[model samples]
Target: MVSKIIALSQGNREYVTDMRRYFHMHPESSLQEFETCKRIQKELTEMGVPFKVVNDIGVIAEIEGAKPGKTVALRGDIDALEITEKTGVPYASTVPGKMHACGHDAHTAMLLGAAKVLWAMKDEFEGTVRLIFQPAEELIAGAKIMIEAGCLEGVDNIFGIHVASAYKVGQVDCTPGPRMASADMMTITVNGVSGHGARPDQCIDAVVITAAIAMNLQTIVSREYSPLDPTVVTIGQMQAGTRANIIANKGTLELSIRSFSPEIRAGLIESIKRVATGTAQALRGTVEFKLTQGTPPTINHEGPTEIARAAAKEIFGEDCLVEREKQTGSEDFAYYSERIPGAMAFIGSAVPGPYVPHHNELFDIDENALPGGMALYVTYALKALAE
Candidate 1:
């Protein structure tokens, strides 16, 4: 079965690559993937696969096997980043200021290829394979929307893949447990009395208060949390005085927090509020703190992760499976894993030169990795359903 799956995937390589190039030439942003959704549906329709649209942009397709068994789902995000193309490939994005810099185009194509393969072999299996073509992943809102729309209603296990530029082609990382961090955005505003900057004690200084708040916020990670636990508190933007001679009456700070542990994530939010409020009040000012929750940490399930690992070993050989460090980046896929047994594999797609990170205009994946990803998708579905 594995050998047959490999051959099928290899045969579909050109189809997958062409589809990826087509998507690359016509990239779309989050939630606005209407045409991308339409293109996906058109491809599925051509394959004689049935599907339904959700949230106005997501595509859910199912392939049921010959016998009754548990249902497994395979997901691929179909949104592109807001970046201009710079790789200069012949299939470079035609849409100015928008490109598939995160390898989502490849993800979409691989899932489509897997769909075609599994659709042909439906009579040989004993379950269903649900293909989730999710949108708005860049905003980390697509998965929740898909779930609310019942994409995972009867799913027994779920699997996803992300292309990585860090490792060479043919390598894969299926490490279980806390593979990615949780992200949360925060804003802090400080209010103080306005006065002349030359005046020594006439009014409170919001700039000073804001600076103190930013400095104190860093201590939450250093002094409060364990050094071994990976965490980050970054003040990406700060706004203060309007004039150099006048003491500012209001100041604002924007922050991004990343952590792997839910307890630590919750604790960091409270600590940031505490520090900001304390620092503001100490300077005779008041603070207003606001938080916008993002995706939770992507912790892979042991059972599903083992299945993925075994499948990868069979598809790409034992040495192709390598362990990579935990990533501080966040992924919307966490929403699925949080509700059911799920795991996401990182497939190596590194090009020949220096490493270019995802979401950059110069980012791209080696097309040779597509067939392996497609095979992994088919093999994982079969193994999970047979379990």
Candidate 2:
């Protein structure tokens, strides 16, 4: 059965590749995937697949087999980033300041291919497959809305995939637990007296205070956290003085915090606020610290993980499955995992060249990986439903 699904997926490679390139050429951002959703709707309609819209952008479709036993949902995020394209491919994004650098384009296209394959073979299986064309993964906001709209109401298990640029095209990673980290956004604002730079004692230095706060934040992971427990505190944005010769009155720092455990997440927030506030007081500056919750860790359930691994092994050779370290990067797919048994697989799409990570303007995937990804989805769906 798996081999048949693989053959069907390979046969439909052209359609998947074309759809991926089409999405790559015309990218849309977040909840603004108006035309993207329309295109998806049109494809499903042409395939004779049944679907309905959720929260104006998300699309949920179902493919029932000959008999119903259990339902498994396959999710594909469909939002692009606010980035300009530099890949220089013929299908490089035509939309300026927007690009599908994260491979959500490939995700959507491959899932569509899987839908086609599964629909064709529905007579052999005895359950339903739910297709989720989710939006706004870049903002980590779309999955929640889809859930609120009841995408998971009857879902027995869930599976997702992310295209990876770090490995060769045939390799896949399906590690079972705690695969991706939780993310939280932080903003630290430092306020101090302003004065001429030459008058050292006359003004409180907001720049120095902010710099101190940023450095202290690093300790939350390095010193406070166990080395075995991975965590990251990154201050990515900093803004201070307008002029080089003046002591700035205010400085703001933007930070990204990530971890796998809720306890560790709480500790990170507590330590950050403590350090920032204490550092500011010592520097005779005032501080306002803010933290906003983002996505949680994408912890894979053993059931879904085994299903993915089995599917990968059955479709490709045994060596195709690769062991991978947990990722500090965050994903909104964690939302679904939190509610139901869920797992995600990493499908390699790296080409042989200078490597570029996701969200970069130069990011591109080896299109040869599309068919394998479709096969993985279809096989996983069949395996999960059978179990």
Full-model lDDT for every candidate: 0.94, 0.92
TM-score versus the correct structure, for each prediction:
0.97, 0.90
lDDT of 1 by residue, 79-196 (tens): 9988989999999999999999999999999999999999989999998999999999999999998999899999998999999998888899999899999999999989999999
Estimate candidate 2's alpha-carbon lDDT, on a 0 to 1 scale: 0.92
> Which residue runs does candidate 2 get wrong by more than 4 Å?
191-211, 239-250, 281-286
Q: Considering every candidate listed, which one attains the maximal TM-score?
A: 1
lDDT tens digits by residue: candidate 2, 27-101: 999999988899999999999999999866889999999997899999999999999998899999999999999
Against the true structure, candidate 1 has what lDDT? 0.94
